[model samples]
Target: MGVVSVKKSVVLLSLGHACVDVYQGAVAALVPFFIAERAYSHAAVAGVVLAASLLSSVAQPLFGAVTDRRALPWLLPVSTIVGGVGIALSGVSGSYAVTLAFVAVSGIGVAAYHPESARVARIASRGSHTAMSWFSLGGNVGFALAPLLVTAVVATGGLRFTPLLVLPALAGSVLCLPVLRGLAASAANGSVAAQAKRPDDRGSFVKLSIAVVGRSITFVGLSTFIAVYAQERVGGGVLAGTIALFTLYVGGAVGTILGGRLANRWDRVTVVRYAYLVAVVAVAGVVFVPGPAFYLFVAATSAGLYVPFSLQVTLGQDYLPSRVGTASGITLGLTITIGGLASPLIGGLADATSLRVALAPLIAMPVLSWLMFRTLPEPAVMGADGSDGRQPAPDVGHRGAVAVGVDAPGQVGDGDARQRS
Candidate 1:
């Protein structure tokens, strides 16, 4: 009534952007730009980015599992420190080998993020489903905003200013120190408490996992390589083509907000399933569309398909009540890594045939994603809290551990159980 009570939502969004800034600018979007600026081959760019995705994705699940048992409040600041350093160094890298190393180290920082951030949202919010929708929207926004930031700097300051570009990230990192300290202190004092225990959904999880992995081949293919695609295949200036990638981001931004709204009002699965149908059309259209007219439809594909990302993350968070950290990490990390891995193969196909010819697999991904999601039970039918169509929260009283705040694992140290183990 007095002031809008969206503190939790704000915090979630900020964290999302923090995660986004760490990767999109320095890793994903940077790959091709670096190739052009540094004069490297397309395959080499794919390989370096592959290193990034693999490390980040693999690390997320492992770290998420760790956070489940122990809360470490300092991870936020520490991760920012590592991420900032890696990014700053990357901007200055003179050789492809060194750049690859920089991206790999930066990947570690990004890898540390999802598990803790997702877990925090679950443990902190009363409505994890709705919260995750907004939570994921934050990340979506950040990804959308990255190119603008890159364009602004490169436009005004030129590529030389890139190395010093770590300043903003460093500032963001330093600013989080107080926030992380408070989280740690609260966890240490036992001020935060565990969420209600929930049943795990083995079968639904498997199905969703397959769906996301399938979808990722398309999502990553588009996200990672779209800018380059425009330059080479779309018959536009590099700057124009670069801006074209922003169309996808524009679509994605809308999709994130729209996806959240859909999750709040309807079935998350319905929204996600529909996104695939749009993606299939978009991928095909993008491949065949000629000249400037093609950009408009590509933008449509981006908007229609990207909106469901939040839905996917929310579903995963809801499904794994006891393991939000691990689930978030895997959902994001593994799925996108699949795309990252497959992109090189796509690039090779383009090398042999053509860029348009290599992208055929992208159309298939959504179909597979949709089919896999359909087999799982509807979230509402299974008493899902807007998660994977899985079991509901277990009785809270039965669990032995008591977690506090968002950092139930080590990001925030949980208090020692008052009762004996």
Candidate 2:
């Protein structure tokens, strides 16, 4: 595909991504409304969040496996519609059980959308992590927009107008149709899968998963408590906390974009390694440093943690080339979900001890994750054939080593980085 064509495809898919994830974000925003309107207990509201998390994060692989088994581009728009509709209907329901059900429905849509979307994005990206970053940035922006959108809807018309929230999803679903057609057309032609021959690097993927778990735990913990941590650390109350939290999340979004650009010039694995190392320093600074310096480290740490986020999804797709959908599901779903699951424990620790002590564990996580990344062997297909198995740069000639195992059949490199014998 041409550059413009690829760009258009990525934009469309990213829109669908944003639309679907907005529901996930909406769930969080909706919790306060539930408290106000339904008088739901803290545990009950948590149940709602838990329901969304379980269905959305856990079932992703199943949806992905199905997509891998067959072409299902249709799921993109269908899931988008379902996701938004679920969220729209959530607040209108009077029964707590019914509300939980609606949120879970939205969560299911979120689950179904991710794997196939990531697969198509990888194809459209043609191996550009920078392009993939744009796709990921869509979801980040969506999550950020959720609160604003939800608040506006509720403030203007109250909970009754919540159904209006479905408009974005409706628009996104319609827009994604053409993008789906483009993806289907590309699949009919020779695809990225056809261009590069790769073995299933399951061993490496498992190691990557371990590393993701570490980052996820640290990320979600910080995300859950950064505002609170800011309030306590700076003694600046809610506004200061809000600003600190915003800085952290915005830094992450910016880092996701920057990492993609860096990947164009250097090895993705190298970029990931350096990002984690930076995270180690930043996280330590967050714990040890006080005052304004703490907020600076929060932003620095967020950037470091997020730089590799999109890269890992692409890497997972490369690792399990034959099961791209499944790879996307795991990398995008379970790892982060499991980390989110750990946040309560982190909170409990904070309850039992000081917030600083609870955060102390976070400082060590990046160091461990950085070491785990060290165990990741660069993908054999990375530079084989002079392409990073992604779309080649416009100026780069397609002259170099053919995919290493194209002619000879054997496994790719293992974690040790030794070439296949």
Candidate 3:
């Protein structure tokens, strides 16, 4: 494939990624509407969020494991449609049980879409951190847009108009066609080579996963309640909440791009560790700061948490070269969604006490993340051809040695290499 074609494929994949994640963001965006329309308690609405994540979390790793053994590009479009359909139907019925079920169905679609999409994105990106960041930025944009989209559609027409929410999914599914065709053409031409097998670094990946879980809990916790919390802090009603949520998510777009640039200069582990340190301070500010200043802190927290977002996905893949699918699934899917598991607990606490108090505990999550990252070693960088590449000089303050590189077993020319310093 030519450079133009590769860039086009990556762009389309990123758009498709945006479409699918709209539903993921929409789930949170819909929380306020659910409360207003149904008079559901904090815990009750949190259960709805739980439904969206519970099934997805369990199914993501399974899907990744399956894709590890077989490439399922078709899942991209199919899952996109399924995810949209579930969310589209979620608010149509008033039955709480039915809503939960539909949301769970959406979760399944989301779970199915991520592992394969990550694989495709990695291939299309050719192992460039900037390219992968753009792919991740698409999802962040989707998340940022969800509030505005949901508020526009459902706020004016109420939850019954949720069918309109399916538009992005349909659009996303169509977007997948050209990219899939391009991939097929590349495969037919044998431009895609088989990956050389390498050993998996299970220990580093475990530590990385734990750090991701911490970040996840912090991010998901904030995303779930930041809107409502904003209202409590500022008094602009729904508009205040929407703006806050947007600020939080939009900051992530900035962070993803910034992370890519930073990774090009420093090893990913160092970048991630420092980002978490920033997060620890930023999260505290978000919790205690008053008035519109709260928005600034929210943005800081989002940016700090997200600066390592794409880097972590690539790091997980590098740490487990032999299980890219599983790594992608865990980094991009399982561990990320696992944060949702805490939503109910947060909601229950909010119900028993207050949103502020419930969220206060989140301040420590990034601290734990920083601690985990402190112990992680940077994996060996791979070349564009899937061979071990020259190691860059160690970054200042980096403690762990860069591990020796190995050619992992997989399709070669998939762009699994880090940028050369």
Evaluate residue 109 in candidate 2 and report its C-alpha lDDT on the 0 to 100 scale. 86
| Candidate models: Cα lDDT each | 0.61, 0.69, 0.81
Please give the lDDT score at residue 259 for candidate 3: 93
Q: Rank the candidates by lDDT, best first.
A: 3, 2, 1
For residues 1-421, could you state the per-residue lDDT of candidate 3 as single tens digits? Answer: 4323768877898899899999999988999999999998899888998999898988988887766656677999999999999999999999999999999999999999998788777766767788889999999998889999999999999999999999999999999888776655555443323333456799999999999999988988888888899999887999999998888888999999999889888888899899999999999998889897898899999899999999998888777765667778888774458778999999999999999999999999999999999999888864545457533211100011111011222333222221110
Best by the lDDT measure: 3
In the range 258-331, model 2's lDDT, one tens digit per residue, is: 88898878877889989999998998888778898898899899899889889888777667766666778888
Tell me how far the alpha carbon of residue 203 in candidate 3 is from the true structure, in angstroms, after superposition. 0.3
Query: Where does candidate 1 have its weakest 10-residue lDDT segment?
Result: 412-421
Residue-pair clashes per candidate, as listed?
Answer: 14, 4, 12
lDDT per residue for candidate 1 within 348-414, as digits (tens), equals 7767787778776788887888898777665432232334332223112113343433434233233
Q: lDDT of candidate 1?
A: 0.61
TM-score of every prediction relative to native: 0.84, 0.80, 0.92
Ranking by TM-score: 3, 1, 2
